[model samples]
Structures are given as structure tokens and as C-alpha cells.
Target chain A: MNPRKNGILCLLLVLMCGVLVLSGCGGGGAATPPATPPAGGSDEPAAGEPINVGLNLELTGSSAEFGLSGQNGMKLAFDKVNAEGGVLDGRMFNYIPADNKSEAGEATSATTRLVGENVVAILGPMTTAAVLGSIQLVTDNNIVLITPSGTNARLTVNEDGTLNPWIFRACFIDPFQGEVAANFAMDVLGAETAAIAYDIVGDYSGGLAASFKQTFEAAGKTVVREEQFSAGDTDFRPIIENIKTAGPDVIFVPAYYTDDGRFVLQARDAEVTVPILGGDGWGSGDMVGIAGAENMNNTFYVDFVYMDDPSLQDFVSEYQAAYNRAPDGFSVLGYESAMMLVEAVKNAGGTDPEALRSALENLGEFTGISGTMTFDPETHNPAKTAVILESVDGVKEFKQIVEPK
Target chain B: MRWTKYLIWLAAAGAFYALTLALSGAGFISRFMLMTMVQICIYIIMALGLNLITGFTGQLSIGHAGFMSIGAYAAGFLASTYGGRVSAALTEALGGAGGAAVYYIFILATLAAGAFVAAAFGVLLGLPTLRLRGDYLAIATIGFGEIVRIVLLNTKALGASSGLPVKNSVGWTTAYWLMLLSVVLIYNFVNSSHGRACISIRENEIAAETMGINTTKYKVMAFALGAGLAGLAGGIYANHMYLIHPNSFNFLKSFEILVMVVLGGLGSITGCILGAVVMTVMNNALSAFPEMRMIVISVLLVVMMIFRPNGLMGTTELRLPFRRKAAGGKEDVTHGL
Candidate 1:
């Protein structure tokens, strides 16, 4: 250890100081201007009155795509509202976005920063686990937290069925998708037995699969075979072989589109053809590219709304016109949630936390591009129409819309 | 000479604590800043623990996060199940819950509980796995970390993947003091006779063994001490975030901590501290630059490794303020007993 090299290292220390100082500017502010700069006379401009809605999305981690989509949707909603002369006496809904990095702890920290910003409500954290991790902080802060697409059944409801006041979601819970899929398979597809091959590593898939199985079995139909595969698994031969052996009337592969490609390809390769069912996570065009249109035939999944649905054309075009891309379930939900928040703020007449929460709870019926949503004030879950879109030669076609009983 | 140096270190640390307290008191520091500062302290303690084994003792225990997970769960269980009861009881003795005394007692108790549990497991793990060296040791530690993660993931009591959420009685003051205390204890141990035995083994195990040093015993001791420190860090972490997920302490986490030790210069306390602070702050700060964050971090790490293979501080410590005079070919006051 030459002491002379210490001199160079000390210079590096000074260099590190520069890094720290630069980065400090980025993360420096406590809460991005705490609660509207006091409204201190001097003719506050329109920008000064913008409502700070916190967006705690998974912008740069494993679930970056979904978070980005959600962000885009919210941004569109904000932009549209702002362009139309803003909300609540020309107050633009200014959003402060925080990337949670798709980690739970980061989500909590991000939520804290958002709360400190004194946002009337937080729009998202995209995924279920991130939402769960962030929930406590928002609850403690008494800010309404409306996730765009967090569908885990237990998110808003505890095991004992107690409801968390601050948490709400624009998307229907997992049970709705499971029930919709079960009823669709049982009543429409006329299946006596179903096979489920779910992504074991994902938080959404397992719970969704469980609910589907529960609803299917409770309706006096058996889940013939249940196979597990992790998210990154490429081979579906072993599981597909087992599913083929079981020979259930329908096969449920409840997973993200990322996992859908390999499984669908391999299952088709094995020539084990049955209607493959999934949840909203399967609503992506990548499925066609990977598994081929022929392989994706007879496949259906439950989603909030199909992009090709005539009623959704306005939203689809708006999203495409705004971002140059078609809208997915995440973006749709993000758009709906942001719009709903704007409505709530309008209904409450101000951003008073309690008033806003009550307005959100009693939002009753919200008709957005996604569909008509009637929020259950008790559970904070939405009762909305779940659409089953069938893949016909790599293109999704309208199958049927299942109304919540 | 050493006594005066340590006292100076203490004074410097005290001043730092006071300065931060004043800053936050004057509302100069944001809650987010305070949170980041606390996180740096926790990571520093963790890095120091890893530094003891992998750096000083030359044992590559990559699964340092395993001990941390164990410690966190243990602390989480205590705080969630009995935190209120204990706090209330202690509050009855020391006036009320409004005071800081009860919180200190409660947090220290949880930290100690976590440390003992992790240390006991460390002794259990090190007894058999210490025989393996280098990569083999790393592999074994990785397995241990994975196993702990899986166990926690499946445990219904801990909320599995969703994670166990608990309110914490800890704040910046508790975190800062705990870190300073850990660094001082480690410094004292490093300058002690047992520390030399461990260092001797690290330098040359065969020679140290031939010189009547109980190499295995010293190695195991270093491991337990290191693990205990990791547990302490974990306990603070759980309190800091108010949630503990097994996935957060996975294999990648172990690799990150190892990167800190190596990037900080293995076997150098100040190096580990520097590494820990830089790594943690960099992670948070990089988030501010969304798009270029990871790219910048990766490029910087590559550049650092290419130019400064020995790391920022290398084997030499940054002598703060009053420098100690080197004399008699030795820096430590302890003369082999």
C-alpha cells in the first residue's frame, strides 16, 4: 500500500464528492414543494395551483413495462384534463412521479416522499407486491392510494375480511378474473374439467390460478391437473405432457405474456390442443409473434376490455394518438384510475383528504374506456365487465362479455 | 497513543451526530434525506461485518444476507408480536411512551435478540463450512442464504412473499449510534490479540497453524462476530422500512454486499465504510436519473475496477483530522497480549 497512491485515491475521494453533490441535487428536496407553496398572495399562476397527484410506479425494474404503460395512461389523462382547461377552477392535476425500482422497500420510501409532497391521492405502484409494501405508509398518511392494476384479491381486504380505507384499485381483483374464466369455461366452453399450468414465481399467477380452481371446483367441476413453471422457464414439454395425459376439457395457463410464448409454443409443438385460458396478463401482441397465430387459436383470457372492442376504440385511438402505441390493460387501468381521481376531486369540490376519500369511495359508477366500473365502497374493489377475447389466427376477436353477478 | 486516537475518533463521531441532529432539528434535512442517511448507516454496519470475515479473515461468505434475513425475521417477530407490550411495560417504569428511553430499550432488545440468533446460527454454519475455502465457502454460504429465504418465503406467519409489515420505534438517532458503536467495537477487536490470530490465519493459514494458533477457532470466532453484526444491521433495516421480505435478501443482495467489500478494498475498515456509503447513496441517487442510472453505475464500477483494483481506500485508512504518529514499527498498543 504505497502512501503515494493514497494521494491519487484522495483525488478520487474528491471526485466521489462531485458525484455525491450532483446526485444530491436529484434526490435533494424533501417532498418536491410541500403542499402548494402556501398560496402566498402575489397572484399565484395556474401552474401554482396544479394538484400534485403522486405516481409511485415500478418505472425501472422487472415490471418496468407495466409501470411505464401505467405512467403513460396517467400522463394522457392528466394532459387531456389539463388541455381542457384543467380541473377545480383551472387547477391542473400536476403529478409527481416516483420510480419504486420494483422493490418493496423502495416502494415504501417512494410512498413516503409522495405523502410528504402532500398529494391528495397516489395513482399506482402497478404490481400487487409493490402495492402491498407501500400500503402501510399511505394508510398512515391518510392519503387515498388507488393502484391502476394491482389485482391480488387480498390487497384491499384482510384475511379477516376487514377493509383498508386508503387503498383502492381501478382494475378488478384476481377473483373476478378467476370467476369470469371459470364461468366462461363451464357455461360457454362447456368444460367438465380444467387443467392449470401457472407461473409459480409470479405473485399474481398463483393467486389467480387458485381462485380459478376454487370457483371451478365450487361449481362442481374438477381441476384435473395443476402444473407449475417459473417465469423464465422455456420448456413446457414435461408439464404439457402431464396436461396432455390428464386430458382436461380446457387448459388454463394463468401467466404473463412473457411466459405465455414459450409454453404456448411447446404445448402446440406437443400437439396438445385445447383452449388455453389466462388472465389480463396475457393481453399482449408478443404472444402472436412467439407462439404463432395458428398456435394461439382457440386461446382466450379474461381482461377488463379488449382493445378491438368498438366501445374501446376511442381510448385505443387516443392512447395510440398520444403515445404512438396501442393501449394494454395497465395503461387502460392507469387512464381510468387517473380520470376517476380527477372526478373524485371535482365531486369533493376540493382536495380535502377526507372529502376526496369519501368521494372516491362513493364514486358509484365510472364509465371509462376500460368499461363501466361500479366500485364497492366496502371492499374498494370494482365490479366491472370482464371480457373474454379469443385469439383467431394471432389476432384477438370478441368472444363474449361476462357481467358480474 | 491508541487511547488518544480512539478518543479523537469518538469526539469526531460525536460532532457528526450532533451536526446531523442540529440539521434535522433546524428542518434543513428532509425526511427522505434522513431515511437515506439511516440506510447508509445500516449498510455500513453490514459492510463492516462482511469486512471482518471476507476482508480481514479472508473467508468469502457471500451469503451475508442470510444472517441479515434471519436477524430481520427474528426482530420483526418480536416487534410485531411483543413490541407494544414490552414498550408499554418499559414505559410504565420510565415515565411514559412519549419519552425516548422506552424506544431505546425496545430497539436494543430486538437488535440483541437478532444478533444472538444470527450469531448462534453463524457458529452452527461456520463449524462445518469454515473448512471450505474461497469459492467453495462462497457456494456454501449462497446455499445457506437461499435456504433461509425459501424458509421465510413459505412461512405463513411472516406473510410469505407479500412480506411482514411492522411499525418501528427506531429513528435516525438509534441507527447512527448503533453504527458508530459497531465500528468502534470492530476497531477494538481488530487491534486486540485475537484479531492478530485471525489476521495471521488470513495471511497464511499453514504458517499460522504451525505457529500454535488455533486457526479454525479464530476463523469461527470471526464468522460469528461478523454474522452478529449483519443481524444487527438487519434488525435496523426491518425497523427502517417497517417491512421485511425474503426476496429483498436474495442471492443478488449477497452479491451486492460482497461487491461493497471488494469494491471498498477487502480487509480495510474505512474502505468498507466508504464502499457502503457510496454504493447505497449511488443506488438512491441514480434513481433520480431514471434512464441513465444503471448504465452510469455499471460504467463507473467497470472504470473503478480497471484503474483502482485495490479499491477506493485500499488497505490504508483515511486518518480523520488528528493523525496518529506511527512509532516502534507498530500502530496498535496491544503487543500480542
Candidate 2:
């Protein structure tokens, strides 16, 4: 063999050795022995490096608006906490956001990667299904997930009616919001009969609609013409025509902004003259322009909390100054979630996820933008009040807050 | 020479099996690595089967995932419903054989069932659409995918939209090893005379027919076999993940499989393995940069296609990195034991 060729081969071998060395050294972090607590009762930043805090929020795609809102609120909360000299005595928090693509599969892959990175905790994916994926992946590695917007009833419920210990949500779920809408319908509108139209594919929409029906029936009003449609179904004329024949005083359309806006317009065009009611999903400003003011008159909905209160007036102003728009229910949920996560970390006295999880479970009197919340020991869902909103000229004007009975 | 090749292959297989055993019971990182390797092995099986038709035999199937979904749900349902009964029957038949025997038979039956069903679906899909051009075939398959998803999501008998859960780990481990072995068997099969005929059809249909190759029959057979292997992967995945949701096997999954085959180089076995491993690693690495991951992946893919479209290894198996001395001066494959 030529010496030059031999040298080249030797060089390649060295390069391969270097690569192997790097990979081995890199993976050594996983095998480190567990950290032992300090002997003394002193609480400091462990004398060396500050622990890295991970924030995995959906930062782009179909739910980009919600993700951006979550980003802003979390940034604000972190800024405020760092200003007051950080949690665990100046262990600074760092944020690392990932896009969930508004898809569960993407969320699973993202959570898996975060596990590999060995982050202490994750913040938001905004949607219930996305949160569900993160919960299973993160909890296996003892990583805490604090989500703000996922309000599905099943997030806290197992098949055998037990609570999932690893997952916790800041926002009140669908059943509470549904009952809020139900009470508002009975007390405010004095309606006798209601028609229902909901999306079949969306678990949230279906769950909320069912809760609303249960509450409405419990309140002594009959529900007529329960019809279902899928997400992105453009035609709602048949459903409207069916509802029109039933002649209900009010109709409940539990859906997101995109379909809710179109449903309102189509229902009006088909001469279905009835007041429309929805849940927090209908709190977007885009709905106002999509449905038009004329079509949205006398529409009532339930949401996290109303932003029109005097205490929340400054937040609304600040949000408008920052993003140039009135803060919606989603924005409020994001803010509350960030606040709740911070509170849990502070209460735990350290960034340890297990300690923080217990702190979250025992969380009491944490005053948030939405309402004061306390997670019931049995279920990780926050026990709080739901605020009702009435759409006047297509804008969600505050009505009243309903306390859960 | 062929015996030597077989010996080398057997040694490699033994080494890999040993590696899996060493990694499986290791700490967290090693466990994760092995799990990922198992996933890659399953994906390779699916991609290789797809390659048989789309690469060698020339048939288009955009809805390969639809057949996979069927296989997954079927496995999940069977495992949950009649698992105990089947185990008992197998135990009764093979009196003192114990749990291992039951596990072996159950997994074999599941794979066979999956292949049979997937092949049936392929034939059903192929009979009408064989005469159609490429794009039309793509559209037909896409429609089939959507239809299957809708049906699976709504069918209450198959657990409806809630999804079917898989709970057996032994079944999954068995399936993974099965897939790895099947991949090797497929590599050998594709290098055989039948595969030569299939490739001839791919190179030129009319010429292959003039050479007495039954183009239609071979194409259908290739598609059916590809679909069968995809189904097998689906069955393994269903049992391993412990949840077989209809949504898991959609058009997006088919696209990912396509990306693997394309990146691996269409006709190369080693290339397929390299592609699958690299893509999975890239996927994990880019988790931190989710917003920019797609951009990076897309750029890499485009650059690769633009430059080395033949892929890292083109139409070749992983050979000894040595050259043999020919009639010329000493080549690189020299000085063997």
C-alpha cells in the first residue's frame, strides 16, 4: 500500500474515533448518579450552575395565534419572577419553545426529544389532545407538564375514573364552562327550548355539547334537534333547516371560532332566527368579522374569565399596547397558566418536578387573571369560577361570573 | 465464495442480536436507544416492502398506510379479545410448551393474518386501477386512505374512534426480531431470479414483456407483497405502542415512509437502513428547534436530491469495505485472512 493512502486511512480512523468519543462523552450525562441534597438547611442555587427551565409551547402553525399569546404571557411571568430574584434562590429560568403543529403526533415527537434533552419541566401545547400526548411522554421521565389551555374533561380522568397524577391544567374544563352557559341561558335568556349543533370529530366540542345538554336538562329546559357536523364542513344549511323546523328559542353551537363564525352566517342565511350560544372556543375576535354583527346579535357564550373587569382593565390595555388588540379568552388562559406554573414552582421551594407536582396538587388561593384556583387533591383540574360573555354586535361583552354549585 | 458471504452475514446477525440483548436491560439512555433502533427496524421492513413495488416492480400505492391501519387494528383487537383463548388453545395443542410457545404461535398467526388481509386489499385496489397512469393511481390510493380512516374512526365494532390498545411487550419484541430477519430475507429475494425479472419490468415494461415476463402478474404480486410487509410492520407497531388509533396511519405516515425510501436510495438495502437511522436521529435532534426543524430537514432533503440523488449507497448491500485484486495492479479489496 502507498504511504499516502495509508495516511489517509489512518486519518479516517482517527476521525471515526473522535466521533465515537464525543458520542460516548455526550451520553455520559444520562448515567450520572442522582444529586444528594445539602447537609445543612440552607436553600441556595446548589453552589454551581443554575438549572435550565424548559418551556415547550406550540410556537407556530394552525394554532399560531394561541401559541404566540402563550409565548407572550409566559415571557411576562418569567420576567416578573426573575425581577423578584428567581425561584429556588436565583436559579434563573430559561425558555425553550417547540411547535406542536396543532397535531398530537408532532407533540409526541417533541416531548420525546425534550425528554432526551432532560428538561425539568414543560409549559404549554394549548390544545387538549396535544397536552394528552405530552403528558404520557413527559411523566414517564418524571418531567412535569403545566398546560394552560387544554380543558377537556378526560385530561384529568382515566378509564376507571381515577385522576392522572402527572398531568395538571390551569384552565377550568368543559363541564364547568358548559354549566356556566346553561345557567346563563336559564337565568338571563329565560329560554324554554334549545337546539344543539356541534362538531363530531372534535372531542372538546362533543364533550362540551354533552355537558351543556346535561346542565340544560337539569335546569328544566328541553333540548330539540341535536345535530352534528364535522370540522371544516362548509355547508350547515341542512342542520339549520332541521333546527328551524324544531323552533327552539335558543341554539347551542359548541365549536371553535372558524366553524362557529360560518355556522352563524349560514344559520342566518337559512332563516334560522334564534339566539346562538357557545363556550370559550367562541371567544376569538375573528368570529366578529366572519359572522358579521347582524348575524351575531344576542349570542351568549361561556369563557375562562371576562377581561372587562376593573382589575383586568390594565392587562387589557397592556395587551392592546403590545399586540394592538383586545385580549381574548385564550390570552387570559395563557396568562393564568403562566402565573399558576410560577406559583407552583415558588411554593415547592425548588425546581424539582416531583416537589412542584405536589405543590401544584396542594395549590390553594393562587389568585390568577381568570380567577382564584385550587386543584382538588382527587383531580388535578383547577376548581374555579366560570365567567359568561354575551356577544353584542359580534364582540364578547362581559355578562357575569358563575360560581359552580 | 457464496458460503463465505453467508458466513459473514450470519456473524453480523449474531453480533446485532447480541447488541440488542446488551442494550435492552441497560440504563435509561441505552433503553431509549434500543427502543429507537427497534422502531427503525420496523420502519425498514415497511419501506423495503414498499420499495419492492414502487422501486423494482413499478406500481404506485399512496395508501399503503391504509392497509397498515387494518393490520394494526386487527392485531390490537385480536390481542385484546381472544388473546387468552388463543393462548390456551396453543398450550393445549403443544401440551408442555409453556408461554413461549403460545407467544410464538400468536405472533406468527397475527403476521400471517396481516399479510393476507393487506394482500387482499392490494388485489382489490389493483384490479381496477392497474391500467391507470401514475398520478391517477396516486389519487385513487389517496382516496382509499381517506375512506379507510373514516371507516375506522366510525366503526364501533373495531373500538370506534376511541382506538384499540395493545398490551403485550413480548409480542412486540418477537415482532421486531421477525422484521429484522424478514428484511434480510427480502434482500436475498430481491437479488434472486424473480427479482431480476421484476427489475427488468421496472427498467422497461415492453422489453420485459418481449423477454416473456408477465408484467401485469409481476406488478400485482409486487404490490401485494409490499402491502403485506407494511401490514406486518403495522401489527408490530400496534402491539408495541399499546394503542392502535386510526389517525396514526394516515396519509402523513405514508409520506414519511416515502421520504425514508427516497432518502435511502430506491434500490439499496444498506442505503435504506442508513436513511431510516439518520432521519430518526435528525427527528430527535431537531426536537428542540421544532419551529425551524422542518426548514432544516427540507433544505437537507433538497440538497441531497439535487446533488447525490443516487443516495449514500446506490442499489448495493453493505459489503466488506475491501476491494479484491483483479487482472490489474493491487486493488483495495486485498490481504484477507
Candidate 3:
């Protein structure tokens, strides 16, 4: 062997060892070991072992903001519960959070790791795509999974309307939300016709648009026009002009904040002045800045809960102080999911998977920060009211809560 | 001597298989790690295929993932439609003995179907665009990838954007063996006379053509073969993951495979394998630290490129220590022993 080549190989070997050691130390330093159960007081039963709850979230990719906010909310809720003498007769709730990187393969790997940690239940991977990717593992393991904001109708139920046994969600399904928005459009706004502009490439927007079209047309109102644009599309004048010519009473834009805000601004610029409604995808704070406050006036959207609700003032203040930002829909839903899981653990009398699952299935009207949520045994979907909020000068003001009948 | 070499290879492979099985059974290797191992194997097959096309044939393909997606969707669809029936029939025919055997056979059939469909697509894509070279060929390939993704996203029969799920799970053991076979086959092809002709074209296309070598036929053949192997990897991946989505095979995936090939030393088969293993492990390891994963990966890539611009192996192959020398007796110093 050449001495120089051997020297280079040795250098590479040392470098590789250095990297392994650094990564090992970094992982140890970052992941704080789960805390032991606290010493019990007279009223509390002897503190049992902590219950492990897994969180698979998109903490670093395109949807990192949503996952980060949810993580904060879950942390706040867990802290509050532990501080007030933890659940299941003073058993602490230990969180095992894994970042899925907002990719399908990563989601499965994250879920697999979480399951390997022996979690009693799992929460989140936020988006529908991430949930679909890993739901098989969760089901195969028979671990209870409560997603905070995966609203695709298929997540909870199969195409044939059979339940996915181990799956449950805190947010309303897309079809239900779409139906509520459509009802509000026809019955409340007295609109005779509706127009929809949605991103063709995204499942959320496309699904919502399809549902809204079905419901609105079912209500005997004409779907005047349906225009499609892909994500990252800038110009909406051509679509807005087509909608304007159709002259619908309202326009539904079921897209995320970035594209939704742009569409609103462009539609207003083109002088097509009809109320632009959307789904929860318009809940981000950046929406106001993207479409100026004035331009966003009179716009409405459906959400899990209205941020300005008087009932949630205490939670709102605590969350704002803790995170230095108001909790969005994802945050509140995350808090609700943790609260629901803890409550089920308490009701089940232990952290046994089967017991906790039964408790969740039989859970009745539990008052959450979002709303009174009750999981339907058949669909595992929470039967809760949807909130309608009107954006007034960039501020989301509470309008009405439409109940599911 | 040749028989001895073959025996040694078989023994080594068997030992590796036994070791992995023991580790997995004893719970020394976690499921996550096993999944990562399967992912590395899949990437190895993909990088090897891409290396044959881009590194040896001198045709840059930015759309290898398209063929992979085709293979995955085709295999997933077949598994969904026929997997259960085939399993039941085999079980009934062979009774208790066929329980696991049926599954292995079904997986093999699914993989073959995936490869065949993908190779057909390769021929379809290559016949038109193989005439173009360089950036034009790259652009055409990119278009092919996007077209596959968009078409799958809109096709209801293929489950649209939601993706199709294969009910029968292919364990890591089966996937590992299949991937190993693919790598061996690709290695053998790259060392054959056809491979030499492909390399000649890469060296100087006009010279090879003027020498009466059919550059067009070899180029198409190499492209189709690479694509077929990639399809086989994709089928294995789909079943191993139990899910196949259009987004999984987007341009980023192709870029990742290309990175492995380039970073491994493009023309070296052993380099592709080493590159795939290192990149996959690094990716899985860094994922533990979500905030700094991409940053660390980028910095490492930059450092690697700065140190060895031609890649880690730089066209050198790794060979068994006891392998015989070439006929000229000059000693093959290109092997990184």
C-alpha cells in the first residue's frame, strides 16, 4: 500500500470517529431524560410510573411553524397538568417528541421510533400527508393516535365508511367544515350563487373545494364558476376575471395563507368585490400582512375556535405569556388533544393501551379550550361545533358557532 | 480459482444474512434501524442504475425517480389487486409449508412486474430523448418526472395524491436480499463488454461511433437497464414502506440518488454502494437533531467536495483482498483494497 494513501485513509477514519462522538454527545445533551414521578402528598396516591405519550410532528420542514406551535401548546398543557398533580392518581405524563421533517418516509420512521419507545398513545404529524404515511404503523401496533389537525376525511374512516379503529382526531373533517362554510354562505349570507378558486395540486384545498361544491350545489345554489391554480401561482386576475364575469355572490378560496392572501389581494386589485371565504388554511398571522388589513375586511373562514373567545381568556393569556405569541388553531387543538388524552388516562384508571382506547371511544362531551368535543364511536371524529370568524381590519372577530346536528 | 471466488462470495453473503437476522431477532437492531438499512439498499440500487446511465454512458438523466415512481405505483397496484388472492391460493395449495414462502414468491413477482413496467417506460422515454444529449436530455428527463407525478396525482385509480398502500408487508430481510441481487447484477453488467462500449461512448461519442460501435443502441440499452433496476428498487421500497405516494418520487428523490452516485465517484460501482450506505446513515442519524440536520449535511457535503472533488473513491473500485491480478500482471492499483 502507498504510505500517502494510507495516511489519507487514517485521517478519514479519525474524522468519522470525531463525527460519531460529536453526534452522540449532542444527542445526549439535547434529549433530557424523562423526569421521575414526583413525591406524593397525603391526598394523592403514591405516584406511579410516568405515562409515555408520543408526538410525531413536522418540526423542521415546510410545515415547521404548525408543528412548533403545537409542540409548545402540548408542553404547556403537560406542564399545567403535572403542576396541578398529574393524571391517573398523580402519574406524570412523559412526552416523547420526534420530528418527521414533513416527509412521508420520515413520518414512518418517526412513528416507528416513537412506538419503539413504548408510548401509550401518539399525537400529531400535523398535515394529512404525514398522517396518511404513518397511519399503518400506528394501526398495526394498535396504539391510540389522536391527530391535532389532520382533517382529511379518510384519516378517520375508510372509503367505505368503516372506522379506522385506532385513529381519532381533534379537528373537524374537511367535508364537515366545507359543509358548514357552504351553509353559512347560503343560509346566513343569503348568497344564491358561489365561486371557488383552489389549488389543484394540494389535497387540502382540492378536497375542501370539492366538498364545498357538492354541498353548495345540494342546497340548490348555483356553483357559478370553478377556477383552479397550482400552488406558487402569482397571478389570479385571469381566474378572478372569470369569476367576476360569472358574478357569484361570494368566492371561496380554500388554500393556505400564502396563496389565499395573494388571491385576496389580487382579487381586490382587480375590482372583483365579493366576500372571499376560505377554510382553516387562512388562520396564519401572515395572512393579514400579505393582504393588507383593509383588503381583508369582510372575509370569513371556518376554524376550530375563535381566538378572541371570552371563555378561553385564561388559556389565551397563559399561552401568550409562555410563547410570546397568541395560540393559533393548531396550538389550541394540540392543547385539547393532550387534555383529552390525559383525561382518558384518568378515566381508564391506568395507562394500559386497551383501557385507554376504550375510554377514548366512550368519551362523552368533554369541554376543551376549543369547544365541547365528543368522539363518535363509529368514525372516531369529534362531533364539535365549528366557529365562523370574520376578518375585520386584519383582526379575526368571532361571528357564530355552527353546531353539528 | 473461479469456483473458489464464487464460494467465498456466497459464504460472505450467507454470513451477512445470518448476522442481520440474529441482530433483528435479539432486538439488538431496532425497527427504525432496520428500515434505514432497507432504505440504504434501495438507494444503492438507484444510485448504481443512475451511475450506469450518467457516469458510464455519458447521458445525464435528472428523471430517474420517474421510472421509480412508475415501478412503485405499478407494483403497489398489483399487490393491492392480486396479493391477497395469490397468498390465499398458495397457502391452500401448499398448506402450512407455504405460509412464508407464498409471501416471498408474491414479493418477487411484484418486483419483477415493477421492473418490467419501469423498463417499458424507460424504452418509451429513451427512444425519443436518447437522441438529445447534455442539458437538453436532462430537461427532457425532468419533464418526464414531473409528468409522472402530476399524472399520478390526478389519477383516481392510482389513489391520486393520497397514494396507494400495499397490504402485504415485505420485511427487511426479503428487501435486503433482493437489493443485494440487484447490486450484484448491476456490478456484473458494468464489468461486461457492453459496459466497455458504453464507457467508450462516454470517453468520446464521435470516436466510438466512427469505430463502427453502435452508440445509439448501447445508450438506449444502458438507460433501459438502469431504469429497470431502479424500478426493482422502487417496488421493494413500496412494499417495505407499505405505502407509495407520488410526492415520494418527486425531483428531490432523483436529486438525492444522483448525489449518492456523484459523491461515490460516478463510474465506480463500489463507490455507489459506499456512498449510498454513508448518505443514508448520515441522513437517519442527523434526523435526530431536526433543527441542524440539513445544515450539518450541507457542511459535510461542502467539505467532502473541497477535499475530493472527484468524489470519495474517484473512479476507484473496492475489491476483495484475495482477488487475482489482471492478465497483464501490472497489478490493478485502482482497487481500494
lDDT of 3: 0.83
The 10-residue segment with the lowest total lDDT in model 2 chain B: B328-337
lDDT of 3 by residue, B108-156 (tens): 8988999999999998999999999899999999999999999998898
Which residue pairs clash within candidate 1? Answer: none
TM-score, predicted candidate 2 vs. hidden true structure: 0.84
- Residue B318, model 2: lDDT of 46
Q: What value of lDDT does candidate 1 attain over all alpha carbons?
A: 0.83
Q: How many angstroms is residue B329 displaced in model 1 relative to the true structure, after the best TM-score fit?
A: 5.5
Q: If you assessed candidate 3 against the hidden native complex, which CAPRI class would it receive?
A: acceptable
Model 1 interface DockQ: 0.44
Candidate 3: residue pairs that collide: none
In angstroms, give how far residue A14 of model 3 lies from its true place. Answer: 7.9
Error of 1 at B321 (Å): 5.0
Please, what is the TM-score per model? Answer: 0.92, 0.84, 0.93
Error of 2 at B15 (Å): 2.6
Please give the fraction of native interface contacts (Cα pairs under 8 Å between A and B) kept by each candidate: 0.25, 0.12, 0.33
- The candidate with the higher lDDT, 1 or 2, is 1
